[model samples]
Target: MPAPSPLRAALLAARANLAPGLVLQGFAAAIVAGYYLAPPVRTALERLAVFRGEVGLPFAVVSTGIFGAVIPFVILRLSAATRNRYTLAQMSALVAFWAYKGVEISLFYALQARVFGEEQTVFTIVAKTLVDQFVYGPTLAAPLTWLVYAWVELRFDTRALIADLRAPGLYRERIFPLLVTSWSVWLPTVVIIYLLPTALQLPLQNIVCCFFTLLIIFMTRRPTGAV
Candidate 1:
């Protein structure tokens, strides 16, 4: 049997993810709508930002870690299909990695706000979103995420990691599919995230990340009667 080309594999992955991606898109849109249309939603989000202001970056790190990694790990464990897929060590590693990512994203967003301007105008939001999804996401975040997952898949073995790095097209094959799915899912979502104030962008991202992770987890559930 022939293996799929990278492009073919990427497209297939994207196709499989289209349903969950749209659900995430809709869910984000609804949140934005509710934020504007419902006073309570706006008030609640503002309270979050105020508390973040009070407690500082540690709050962001912890909350992002919880939402971006820990909650997903817990939920995945609860799902019968994937319950046994990840070991405790891998889960701990994921938490640490995503906790770092939370800090990375916060700094990146701050940098974007400074470079691209913090105003929520269409031009500002579009520019920041483009730079985020294209430049930062592809160049920095996506590659690091790929590396982290690859290492985790290899069970934290250094020798195996070196061997895996030597494979031709390794980065392309591993990252291309991730890029495709990421652009599809997060491009619009980050635009939504950018529409909010700088203080709230990270919180919104944490929420969106949590929701998207759960979506992917459940989407991978086994069919009925599976062993």
Candidate 2:
């Protein structure tokens, strides 16, 4: 039998992931609601500084790492279809996430300060959205995500890595399709994230990353015939 077309495969993956996607959206909504309705939560979040020189960077790193690890683990554990003990691959991915998020948060502040002069306005937000979507998201963030996953899949074998890089249809069949599927989720999500204050952005991103990780795992694990 002929394999499903790429569009069909992407649609199937989206369908398979819809439940978790909705849960993630709802979780984000609840967080937004709580920030407004729950005074104490809002107060605490406000008190948490971001971009405060040395201290804030470490705080963002550790907090994002913890959330990145815990939230995905919980989601994976709760879903019978995904439940499994954490593997080395997952651990490696988590470490990658920790390091990436740390840098990302730092860059976010630096870029904003440099381009937008440390104060957010309509212009700054627009500038940030453009740079994030076009420059950072596609060039750096997306490729890094794929590379990390590919490394994990290849079991850190350097020889396999070189071969995979040279594999025919690697970008066409795998990376492009994954990018298309991912944009469906991340594009709007990042726009919303950029609209918020700097301190809130990484926290929200960490939450969304949990959903993204689970979605990737689910789609990759889909049976050959099922989708």
Candidate 3:
């Protein structure tokens, strides 16, 4: 068989790392959103499985399963080369990280509720608003976080990532081409996550929170070529 193109290999590795983390982060956001919705998707999942009564596991599982499947499918559809060297071991590690987040989020909310009681009153609302301005501000920064992570990852693994950037004949390696190829799919999805509230008449805060969780994935992932 012909050897796998270096660009293809690099991109696949990047995607594989990003994909699972994104799904997990997305799942965390979903749990927060489900809190406001009538359905309570998170609690439902907790009730059904090992995650029973757990805070974020249910939502995490649902979000990860759905987005995890969809993003990879979209990537495969867009680039046949994405289906390269994506090992099961890597996928398992991704899922494990996701589960850790689920547990963490659950513990946090649980602790807050137990210590402070439910946050449905006016005073609590005001306090949360104040916290939002400082302590929780990073949670609102999703787009910037993802972009920075992608850039850093690319730089760290520049050699491995763009090994094929130079062909025997081609002299210049245009970064824009590589970026556009990857972001063509990711950018739209990011935009859609933010836009869902406005388009679907859902709560904007929830959408924002969901995107924030997605951002965390990008922030926390172990950069392959940590520059």
Candidate 4:
């Protein structure tokens, strides 16, 4: 049998990811529904903004690191093999990667909010979602995160990481698929995130990020042969 092409492998990966993607989307959808239909949830989400304002960028960096990296690692902590590979250095890298992402997304969302204004109109939401999923995400967010995570996967081995990048069509083999999966999952979720008040945007992003981190960790746990 011919080996899987990059696109094919990516599709299979995305298919395999549907369960976690759906779960994350459902969680985000529930949050959106709650914000619209439940007063308590709205209040709680708003409070996150208040806290974010108090701490500035550190709020996002710390929250993203915790929800995105720390918690997922803890979930798989029971596996001795898993625990063995990831020590302080690996953990720190993961934290720093996630923290950077948190900072990026927070600033991105804030900029979008400023550009698009804090209106809840359909046009406003659509504009931000379009730029988020199609523009900023594909161009910057997805590819960058995939590369950073790839380094983490190789335990931060610089030479090995360079070889992987130097492989023919790294974009097709790795990044394109990641972007495909990210668009598949985050497209709708980004819309839900943009539908909220400015202060709550980063907070909601962090919440959805929690599930996303869990999904990524789940994927990484799969057998190398299976992937």
Candidate 5:
């Protein structure tokens, strides 16, 4: 049999790259459940780890265990689907999501300070913003991160970055896959947020979360003229 055309190979590689994003999206979903469902848990986290308060260490342990238990399985699933070895790809995907979350978190904190005054810290404000901005923001962000990397790979392969930006949309022919790819990661995340205790069910807040996640993705890939 004849070898696959270079175009076919390149497209396959692009699709493979999206796997990392998908995996990280699942991780982002789980984190939303962990940090948001329990108020005391979030407070304990702020006190012990990121900032200092009177929260106990065991709360951290329990919370981490409760939410983090799913991580291994998620990693396993994503790894099984991808061409890249599981560990490296999972790490890379997570790292991408983390970086994306960092930006959104910083924005959230800044806004929190503005609206609530600096006197109030994030733990004190038990609103929907906590999970939407910090947790789920990274769902879309992870995919955007991988897409940027994929774009870079195209550049290295001597394809114009501008040209490759159009590639994601070229598969408009495959709308279901694109929709499936995006929502498969997003809808489960929203569901987890809804099902867990202390879920922020405000309509406006949910809308904003949806908007921001898409906005982040757009900004990341828009420069390249891709969706």
Candidate 6:
């Protein structure tokens, strides 16, 4: 039998992981709902005092690092093989997430205050969604994610990384398919996120990052034939 095409393979893989995907989506929904309904959570986060002014940039970095990378690493440890240690790849991912969150938060502010010049309005929300989905997300965020994960999987080998860049069909077979899958998840999530107050965006993103990281781990760890 012929092997599945990259897009087909990705579709099958996504279908296989539908259960976890749905669970994560539900969790994301709950977070959005809770953020709106539960005043105390927002109040306490605001009271942190660390998230004020220029401090917020560093706060976002630390918070995202903890939720996106550190917590996931701890969970990975529960498995015997991944216990008691972290690989260089994991460390790389942690650093990448920390840096990305910093930039992400900055861009969020720019989009709200500079580009759209408003918050939670129909025009601003739609503009943010379009820019994110079409421009920044595809060009910057997705490629950075792909490169970081690729670097880790390549064992930080510069030569291999260079070769992979020269590899034929790599973009078609891997990068494009993952981009499609990523947008399927993140685009709508960002729409909901943009609706929230500026102060709440990063914290909520950090919360979502935890579940999203778990979902990635779940999807990636599944057996080849599981799809």
Write candidate 2's Cα lDDT for 77-178 as tens digits.
Answer: 787865763564666576667656766866675676577754556777677777776777667776666666666555566786677778887766656656
Off by over 4 Å in 4: 214-227
lDDT of 5 by residue, 1-227 (tens): 88554445434534554565455545555555555676775565344343312333333333332222224324344654422323444344434443444445345544544554443233434443444434544454444544554453343343565555556653332222333344434444444443322212222123223333332232223233443
Give, for candidate 2, the lowest lDDT window spanning 10 residues.
218-227
Clashes of each: 0, 0, 1, 0, 0, 0
Clashing pairs in 6: none
Q: Would you list the rank order by TM-score, best first?
A: 1, 4, 6, 2, 3, 5
TM-score between candidate 4 and the true structure: 0.88
Candidate 3 residue 151 C-alpha distance from true site, Å: 14
**lDDT (Cα, tens digit) per residue for candidate 6, span 12-103:** 76666566666666766676676668898556656653454557577777778888778888887888976744585666666676567666
Clashes of 2: 0
Error of 5 at 45 (Å): 3.1
**Greater-TM-score candidate between 4 and 5:** 4
lDDT of each: 0.78, 0.66, 0.40, 0.78, 0.40, 0.67
lDDT (tens digit, per residue) of candidate 3 on 1-227: 88445456436544654655466446545654674564666455334433343433555544443343334334444656545323444444434443444444344444544554453555544443344333432342222333333333353355643553343522112232233233423343333333222112112223333433333333334436543
Q: How accurate is candidate 2 locally (lDDT)?
A: 0.66
Model 1: per-residue Cα lDDT at residue 202: 90
lDDT of 3 at 29: 52
- Reference-based lDDT, residue 166, model 2: 86
| Clash pairs for candidate 5 | none
Model 1, span 70-166: residue lDDT tens: 9988877787977886799977887888788888888888999999888989999989988998888878887777777767766687786787678
Best by TM-score: 1
Runs of candidate 3 with Cα error greater than 4 angstroms are: 1-51, 54-87, 129-133, 136-227
Q: Cα-based RMSD of the predictions, in order?
A: 4.0, 3.9, 12.5, 2.7, 11.9, 3.9
